[model samples]
Target: MESPASNSPRMRLDHLRKEGSGETHSRVFELEPCDHDNWSNPRFGSMNALEILRETVRILRYNSSGFMAIAALLICPVSAVLLSNVLVDLSLVKRLTIRLLLVSKSSGLPLRPFIKQSCQKFAEMAISSATCFPLFITLSLLSKAAIVYTVDCSYSRKKFDTSKFYGIICKIWWRLVSTYLWVCMVIVGCITFFFLVLAAVCNSFAIIGFSPNLVVYAAMTVGLVFSVVFANAIIICNIAIVISVLEDVSGPEALLRSGALIKGQTHVGLLMYLGSTIGMAFVEGLFEHRVTTLSYGDGSSRVWEGPLLVIMYSFIVLIDSMMSAVFYYSCRYSTMESSDGEECQSILESVVVSPQAMDVQ
Candidate 1:
């Protein structure tokens, strides 16, 4: 049997195509690999999650610069969020929303004041939303650049694919913001639906003068919403990131592509995301549960949760970085794409091996 020059030669194949050409007709004899040389198979069809995870770590560890750059990017998000809270108070954006909602409801408020408040808050949320993706992308890219482009890194000699990074940013920038908007909308909608349900139940019982249900209803509603949002946040955050690692599409396109591919198989990928997030969140929760209750400052109520949360969030960021690598793997199994080419992408395909025949030259 003639062997195909390019493709899953591991499946056992015969091929006929012009030399130096990519197109060819090849056949496979068995379901299993006839040639086992290809580990980084684009199909990624065989490896389990554990094997993928092992390969992922191996790939990252290949270059020390890659590792360090991702590390810095990991820290950037936590630092930005904490600093933004302390120095800028992003809730001010939501505060504007609150003031507007109030003005709208107030009959005594003048028309001019109502419009002013509404417009101001609307403006704030918009600015906050817009600022978000860029900040995240900048911090991430800056860290990647810092590590990948370092002049003295051992692997610096490996010509960096500069287009790959920009492609990632393009694929994630708008995606993170828009999907996040949609996710928040979904969560708010869910909570609102449940709130109304519980509210009705509460009002019925309260009217009989049995008991006020506001606290219980509110607590239940809040808990359900929090749980859903927290879990979704981890996955969506992964989506934002998985979208980034894609090289074949822009931000919006990657979202569409990934969404379509992730439909039935999001469990492992989502776990790959939320698992890390939950682990970090558990650490943060431990701090809140045991540490905060134990460590109160002299004049400040600060339990140092801020810094610890920041650190844990950074660890999430690292896991996020690592997960993106797997996302690239999982993607190939299902044919998702980005605007970037494989040459420019981070995914590495294994060199498929095949049976050989000694040739007379």
Candidate 2:
């Protein structure tokens, strides 16, 4: 007998059984190396161009990803600015409405436009935010327990445990809501104070055009600087919140950890964030512009468009999360490692210690 030595990709149980012996036997099958090994080069200690693209595609497909990331890459800043403007307008209108009632003027203030605008703005935000959820879920909804569950069933340890993937995302969600509330409180307090000071300055100017008081100009300068600082700090805090959640640390700890991670990498992170913002904005602009046209009692053409845009926007959000996850993991990889199987790279740098390794026992 020739003895079916590696006859095919897989061997039959009958052949293996027949070939079995005390001294020698043919194994049922030979295993191939995991995909990761093929994508990574040991000599280079980094993925090459092809591998990078492949991994990117893998991530997008793996999560059954959405488009928010692509849109986030596009429209983040523009949408943020627009949202801010809408909020300012709505606030102004509300103030006017209350002031009118107090003065007992004809309660016939034009309600249609304001109501329409408010609804439009709210719809935009809610829809955009909701679409962004799935993108976030790509990385947002999985867990370590899920990862362990996946690992338990996986034939190789080299693959990412896709199951618990959302642990980081869940943390981000909780942290963002928490951070948003905190930031809103701070922003509200500061904005209230800012407007008061501005009102005083404006009232002073009301008595005189472009009041020559150096104090007025100085106050103007102060306001500009304050706005810039406030905006930048909040954005940084948002990123820090996400970092914190992924890293599994206290709020303050997360802030410091994010600061460290972002210290040398601010420019890269900025560009990527900007990309997400730009992509989202272009799509948002088109939709909003169309909505503006539709508000003229011509909602006919756009009746079906809103949901379609939302779904497409959600896809972008999905892509946005994937992009963030990719960039994060890429930067997080380290060439150096501790003896106990830990790496020093800073994307959270979480190292889980097993019971056997811990000194607690």
CA shift of 258, model 2, Å: 1.4
Question: What C-alpha lDDT does candidate 2 achieve relative to the native structure?
Answer: 0.40
lDDT digits (tens) for residues 41-98 of candidate 1: 3433423345445544544555545555556555656454533332344566667666
Question: How good is model 2 by TM-score?
Answer: 0.46
Error of 1 at 284 (Å): 3.2
lDDT assessment of candidate 1: 0.44
Best model number under TM-score: 1
Off by over 4 Å in 2: 1-58, 65-93, 96-231, 292-298, 326-361
Q: Which stretches of candidate 1 lie over 4 Å from their true place?
A: 1-43, 46-52, 80-85, 88-134, 140-237, 244-253, 285-312, 335-361
Worst 10 residues of 2 by lDDT: 5-14
Quick one: how many clashes does candidate 1 have? 12
Tens-digit lDDT track for model 2 on 1-361? 1111111111011113344465543321112222322222222222322333344455444332222233344334333333233333445455555553332212212234543454355444544444554433333323212222222112121233222233423334454445434544554566567656655654555445453444345445657866655554544554454454445554555555555544444555555555556777776776667654455465775666654565555555444444444433333332221122232222211221222212221
Model 1, residue 182: C-alpha shift (Å): 6.6
lDDT values of the candidates?
0.44, 0.40
